[model samples]
Target: MRYKLIPFLLLTGSLHAQQTSVLFIGNSYTYANDLPNTLRQLALSLGDTVTVASSTPGGYQFVQHANYAPTLTAIASQPWDHVVLQEQSQLGALPFPVTTTQASAAQLVDTIRAHEACSMPVFYMTWGRQNGDDLNCPDFPFMCTYQGMQDALIANYTALAEENDAFVAPVGAAWSQVRALHPLIELYSGDGSHPSPAGTYLAACVFYCTLFEESCVNATFNGFIDAATAAILRGIASEVVLDDLTAWNLDVDDVDASYTSSTNNGWNAITYTHGGAGTHLWTSSDGQSYTTPDATFVFSAGGSYTISHTYTDPCGNSDTETWVREIVVGVEELEHGMWYRVYSGVPGQLEVRGLRGGEVLTLFDAQGRSVLQKQLSRSAERVVCLPGMYFWRVNDERGNFTSGSVVVR
Candidate 1:
């Protein structure tokens, strides 16, 4: 049988080039047990220069940060290459209760823009503690489940980053990946709020890897711990890719069963029912196979079906795979130019821009009405008559709108 192979992109050699100075603004998640220091050490070992300037109170949220915007603005004004920010874990998870988190995130973005040098990048930091652990100390229901809170936090960070044209460092997902691996990593300390040394090291590893786009090896703790603990720490410090299975098959009469991938790779699986009783299952990887408990299931003739699978890597990386199959039916060809191109001025921002280019460039409103038209030229940037929301077609000779959004302010 022919199998489809998914290529893996490794970061083996890309990180060895340049050194960078980064500023970390977070609470204990960023400074607990000198994680910033560990990050500095890791960078030094890799022959990179890394200095961590941090302002982390014990437990602070974006709202609190906004209250001290002047201080944050001052810190951000410095000539740092990258700035990292982490919100209180609970605030990220339960943003509804604290509605100011979103506003605070926006305010922070504005402050960063005002203070940062041109083109400086901002990275949102993601975090996770142990299951059922409440670091916020209020003991609220929203802070109860690790998985639910983590999902909420990730969603908030993703939205905030997209709105402000920023990047994210998914450390919380990385923690989940490690948890899936051993189920006993215990990212928290005895109280289950603060990170243990191992947990801190893991966070540092993520920061180092993402910031430098490199791998972290030989992260040994100082003499503060014993040898056995150190060995356990080393074991957990290592990174690995987990297998992601996209599809599975079972008899029509059986209830659903859950299967984990060997590593945390992403994949999709689909099953087709045939002849009233037969079920055929296929996964994203051609080599992966699925079978029913009994050989009684098959795909139904002319039936269409699809399934998608997603997984997080050891460092909290995520991807999705889709499985599609039709029983004895020819696939439909996707027609070129059937769909119009869509563009946003700034993601999550109030303004969006759209354009279509050929011999001339045309801009359209959200309603697809042409609002402005411009002539194309080799050296001139495409100028829009009005701002707000517009969509651009890609057929023009000058390349279509740039990949990312534009901010008027």
Candidate 2:
């Protein structure tokens, strides 16, 4: 369901508490060194809470997990905010158009959405082998080098995310950046396939930034790495994930700043409402501002006002929208000392009084469409119309103008 806010009298600062629940599904790549728990600890250090659960067995594949009972059971166990899907390390780097892996990932995403419509399915893009895929290098020469393998993984994961309408953690992309900037750092285990503590730590940092949509630069949980190395890893994660969110499809579900407005007393008692996933701020040209998602403004005077609403997401991404409206309040005198009044007490009629002869009076509907225009020949007139709000303007022969609004019930 979309986020909604009700009208409130008081405007307060927006406070956010970052809390998330995630389910990890993969093989050794995800289970090695307990990546899920590492992410939870990392979040704890940053004053956030992350509940984690996983289903990882040795050498598991996306196809296997899609049909696996344990995976399905975990998905139905609770409403998770995110479901991380990590294919076997080598499967994603296979030759182009790996239909089986892509199809299996799609199937899993379908299951995830069926269980919880709001659960965001994220593809955990893993890095290539430390050296290369010697087994597949003979057949597919592209897998012979670490760079080639990493490139394939990046492409496949990005494609899978797009096809499944999901998000990508881009761990492999960050891994490549780290390898280029800090070649001395080792990100692989003894077999050159599994992740060492450093490798898992880097992956955890990437996930922390991806799932929370926030930076992990100052995270206190080093996760078995020295502070210096952890800091370097965190920087890489930020550059890869936060720098270009659209590249990884992270901005697909960003907040929308559009809103709806209504008023019963012309411009006064105007209420603005919105449905978005973040904090809201409403500002007016007349120096009025409110920090509520939905608010009612009671203006004493009426004129042309430009109102803008800005919505900010949890990750500090924001969007602003503006609207200009003309408002007419109760009866008021014009500069030439001519006064006018609008009354709707009579059934199905608008009784406009105190009008000078030979004045041009125009009636506009709620949508600003001119419904009636006439040159008045008397001091009083009654206009027959349906029940609704309308704006009326009177222009005198001497170039003086008077305007107001009336609601016919």
Candidate 3:
């Protein structure tokens, strides 16, 4: 049976506490050095949490995962955000099994979609055996040399990803890159087939970039590896993965910065709300800024205000927009003089009456941050906000404005 995960595909909520779940299906290479645990640690260091788990028999392949009851049961255990498939280290580098790997991976992909509709199956392209698999070198010509085996693995995995129209977390590519640039890093263990602590960390970094879409450059967890080596591995993963997101067939965009605002004569401030992807940054020229959502802007000499905001996705894409707001500041709307008042109805409650039609009402706390905003309905609408002492403002469609303070405690 498949368990449904709310916020299945996209990581739900901008809050860091909400975790995305990932499953690694492979052999000892994935379980070696506790790779899934390393991935989770790295994610946490970056202020992102990923609930991770893995199933790996000593030398399991895609066919094994597809056929084995335990592995299939693990896949159905929860609606994972990304289900990673790693074929036995040497299979994809071979001829017929290369095609077999593709078919098996596709079958698992279909199964994943059948169960968790939003889950994405990622081909965990593993690297070549250290110095080539001497045990299999006699049977496979490419296994005779390291570079040759790596080349074949790359070709096979890329082909599989293209054929299945799936995502590939190029961990193998990242490994090859590190080997070329930092030959002394020692990614392999004494046995040559399994990964060293550094190797698993590098794999974890690649997955971090692939799944989380964020730079792992500053991640604090270095595993049992040294800081310098960790930094180099992180750099390699970023250069290979983050730089060419499209290569992995990902469609990423800047964070959403949708908002609403009101500019009226009496309020003496701009009642604004940041409802879109909650806010990476909210500000404009002249040094006005608000770091959080729902903020108020008080004009110096009310005329017009140019507002702009920017938001960035975890993938590093950013979007920004600017608009102009006209503020009459009661120049004509309140020329005859007007007055309004706020009253506390009950503990942690307040009420307002005589509001102009289509007016935007906002409440701001002592710190000048906008706490509440609503499009009022002429009569009255209870504006709910945190219990506190706050100043309120109202701006009607006709440019009429009113302002005062109220307390709810």
Candidate 4:
């Protein structure tokens, strides 16, 4: 449970990166209770930073934001790490597929990606009308009931995120969880669509968990909501979000690592286990040396070695893990192709073994950007990679080989 942040990979204008710039694009659900400012204050109370700004027009949908001058201006103002898109409360579940929202969101994602490829487009999954949407009930009977509308909203937001490979903030799901557990809490205003102060605090908690990949239970922000109500909402939000982060497509900066060493012909075989499918890298005992992210390690020495693991999620957030132990090792045969990993990266020459002749080797950066390439004619090769996270894939002529990540620094 105790851990440190992996070396962070963020898009910032300067080197002193401490917080994420988040742009909220929605209507009253976001602007009510000054949600963006509330989130910023919450992050500050928790000793974290989140630069927040928003373009929230009352009753505006994604389609509306798509052409809204204020929205476009805010987006072009900076390279945002995350863009939270909240659809109009009632528009989530309409009579038709709501093709306009879909088109607008996709178009926004494309536009954002054009400027910052790492910028994540997060869909804000809103809650249902407290009672129901009587206005659209005649067109959609499903909207006649609160639960029915909630279900449809969940489906719509989820499909939107899935189709765009975007992230979703399941505030609606958290709202449902809270309603089921603590129905007395007022999450909605009298009109039934807009969020009450309590609801906005709950939304802030969910955002804290989603953006920071940490529990919001201990956060100090309660906004205008009372302590008792805030605590309850915080607990519900934290539980719902952290319990199954993958459901919300959130990747926490945590990893599980274990290593084993054996005195096999003087070869100490070290292995580590880290949760999730993110990219990883390990630091050697010297504290100055590192290896490409690897599950297993081999050392041809007799002494103690401490390896620190740094894992990065798809969006480039990082988590750190450390393992220390003593081991003995002996020279062994180089297993080419199967072992085409970082053998030793020292000085001017970076040594990598495990590639067969007639195989093509390619290296890619953490951003999936191609950095290096080579054709192998020997069982071993010394490929050059700058200081960063990279992976090498071998293709046999038409493309068939193994790939593994390697770290240069």
Candidate 2 structure quality by residue, lDDT tens digits, 139-221: 88888999999999999999888888789999999999988999999999899989889999999999988877788886889
In order of TM-score, best first, we have 2, 4, 3, 1
- lDDT values, one for every candidate: 0.50, 0.82, 0.74, 0.72
181-275: candidate 4 lDDT, tens digit per residue: 88999899878888899999999988877776677776667899898888898888788878887776654223433221111111455434343
What is the Cα-based lDDT of residue 269 in candidate 1? 16
Model 1 RMSD, rounded to 1 decimal: 18.2
Task: Single out the weakest 10-residue window by summed lDDT for candidate 3.
Answer: 1-10
What is the TM-score of each predicted model, taking all chains together?
Answer: 0.51, 0.67, 0.58, 0.66
The segments of candidate 1 whose C-alpha lies over 4 angstroms from its true place after superposition are: 1-17, 73-77, 96-98, 117-124, 133-142, 218-409
User: Mind giving the per-residue lDDT tens digits that candidate 3 earns over 196-240?
Assistant: 999999999998888866678988889999999999999999889
Quote the positional error of residue 346 for candidate 1 in Å: 14
TM-score (C-alpha, index-matched) for candidate 4: 0.66
Query: If both were scored by lDDT, which would come out higher, candidate 1 or candidate 4?
Result: 4
Cα deviation of 138, candidate 4, in Å: 2.3
Clash number for each model: 34, 0, 1, 7
lDDT of 3: 0.74
Query: Best lDDT goes to which candidate?
Result: 2
Kindly provide the TM-score of model 3 when superposed on the true structure, using C-alpha atoms.
0.58
lDDT of 4: 0.72
Candidate 1, overall lDDT?
Answer: 0.50
